[model samples]
Target: MSDYCRICLEEDALDNLLIPCNCKGTQKFTHKSCLHRWQETTLNNYLCCPERYDLEQVLTCRLCKTKYNSTSANFSWRLLYTSSPLLALARKHTCVLTFGISSFMCFSFWLFFPILFNVAIFSYVVFWKKGYRFKFIGTNEGIRLRIYKIGLKVNELKSGTILKATNMIRDGMFKNSKILIVKNKEEGAVGFIFNKFIDETENIRCGGPVNQSSVHVLHDNPDVEGCEKITDGIYIGGKLIPRPENTICAIIKGYSAWDSLQLDGEVRSGLWQIDNTECACLW
Candidate 1:
């Protein structure tokens, strides 16, 4: 690091005259590793505060704003980041920037990839629905999992919707069950048969078979202190207390629960119909 080196301006050490950017005198000569570190820091700053910092500075001189001649420093430049750190604060965000770059590159590749030039990078599965047919691409081991994740996001069910069991669900507990969906997410789903009422009080009737011990009160009371709201005027949880007139409530014990992407399969395979209008009068 001598006075000649633009980055570490010290007359204590010695290094080669690595000029990455076109700057006069003091700003020209920077060590290869030093220039790389500088580029990394610049990119980091640009990512953290995009409005304040410029991205072009990572490959150019700040003063002259000329693109850096990184013909030599381009090789294995990221390996020298641990040597000289830019700032000690917020070092955890390094992966975020790296992931952002990787994601962008992956998205670009997937977007621009033509239907003609399809390479055999990984295994795939063909999905047929309606009239359109496209291949679902994924890796070998985790392809099924990836497919499930993608399917869940696209055709996933939402909470507060009604699921009427079709004839496909033979003579099971949910055969004629018109389940009122309590909650539906990417992970799982929980609901109960609201249409079936055994009696006024809890005798033998239940919501579902999963959680039989617990009791859930589905009511139209939103003013209850600790009740979970479902849709517009419906609320779950909390006990049945004396409330306003015309506010109907169902004392349901036990509820149905489905694991990740489990209900999606049943729904798609024609086990149930996603009816928002048929089960409206029941609640």
Candidate 2:
């Protein structure tokens, strides 16, 4: 009546065996490594069941189809750190290439050194940028901006009236909403907005313009329900909403702006008036 790992078929040991899922007796325990390997191999078999999928990696028991509770704990740091599929693929590729090159050319240090150096530089330029620059141009009523990379633009705002636009980039009217504006020594005048803020999880996106450069705002609300993407932008609820139109606002980047000041709480809050009846504001 000894417990054994259902995955590896090995006798249960203290460090190796884990009761990941809610199964009884023989089907209960599995080796962490074995389970992880199986999950990795069969990752393609999982489908997006909106009701059951919490946007996390889940391991289901093959025998009973019950999802394991401890799957999160078993995830490696690489898997946990990658929030999107593209990033996960990048990490996997990097790991595989590094391992393959190191194993095959362990003694050919001089030959591979230049290749490795070029790869590192290429990675830095492609994946990491020197800095983030946002340009906000003033509209008659509000400001428009975009995010730039190496002088090339990536994100642009979707066209729409003020209300139907993505709330990710808010104007002065959205005061009292959880968005903030601040000045940074390095980044200059910047705005901070949250796409999702709950408990320990906080995701910040920013948008801004220069000269008459207003800080385009990027807000994240991860808990928003029933969000659907359309050709113009995203449709959350019944509204045909456009994505944040400005480049600065459309860029899907996250940063921490804990020191930013809330518009309603700041001195500038007096300059604007919120028309609750119309759901827009005048500044």
Candidate 3:
């Protein structure tokens, strides 16, 4: 492409005047005074103060007031269970009946007792309290899970954390360019998703649900100026939604590419309470 004067829109390449104001001049140049007026109104207005938009807010759960830290990428709460020995015996009986019926159906078609026993076992187990309540928190770094089981030696355990949200996005990496943003497309809300854990020099990989199409982007790429209130999930989409403080981020770390953007019926119904506290995204 031939060099042209940006300011005058001229096609001159020699004796051109170039200034920091991004004004392009040619041999047949426009008056310098004209350039001054253009610079004051057009370019300067768009310039922003660095400090004005650099900081972001931290995130927390609205329910328990639990602030998810950057180190803890995701958080969840599960149901707890209590002891009931009477229920256990009933569950045991049901299992016996189920197996007995299967055996009889194969070898002793003539014996109906086994089938009856199996049916009884099925009912008790289905209605019994053998299942425990559980809460699960998954993050890029690890998982925090609790099982409420009566008489159990331990109530909680750290199952594991995700090394990366997706194979492409690794831990501790961020992408400032070419990020994928998802939103309602109709509502105009927007969220950001970039390749994390990028080598920067060699490879550009993003941390997310591996597949791009499954992720939802938020609308309105608003500056993460402060800790904003936790509204609907639409306000925050794709990967972990970082709080305004920059200390905590909301993430669904272990979900697969197919499951990344899906909101379960329960979550959509607003059945779950959000635990709000202060936290950030940690590697």
Top lDDT prediction, candidate number:
1
Q: Kindly list the per-residue Cα lDDT of model 2 for residues 46-141, writing each as its tens digit.
A: 343324432244445656766666442345533542545764466569978788889778768777888999998887676436433346756566
Span of ten consecutive residues with least summed lDDT in model 3:
73-82
Which has the better TM-score: candidate 2, or candidate 3? 2
Candidate 3 has an lDDT of 0.33
Candidate 1 clashing pairs, residues 3+ apart or interchain: 1-13
Write down the worst ten-residue block by lDDT for model 2: 154-163
- Relative to the true structure, candidate 2 has a C-alpha RMSD (angstroms) of 24.2
TM-score of 2: 0.23
Model 2: lDDT of residue 140: 65
Candidate 3: stretches off by over 4 Å: 1-107, 112-127, 131-213, 218-234, 237-278
Q: Cα lDDT of all candidates, in order?
A: 0.67, 0.42, 0.33
Per-model TM-score on C-alpha atoms? 0.44, 0.23, 0.20
After superposition, which runs of candidate 2 have C-alpha atoms over 4 Å from their true positions? 44-58, 71-73, 76-283
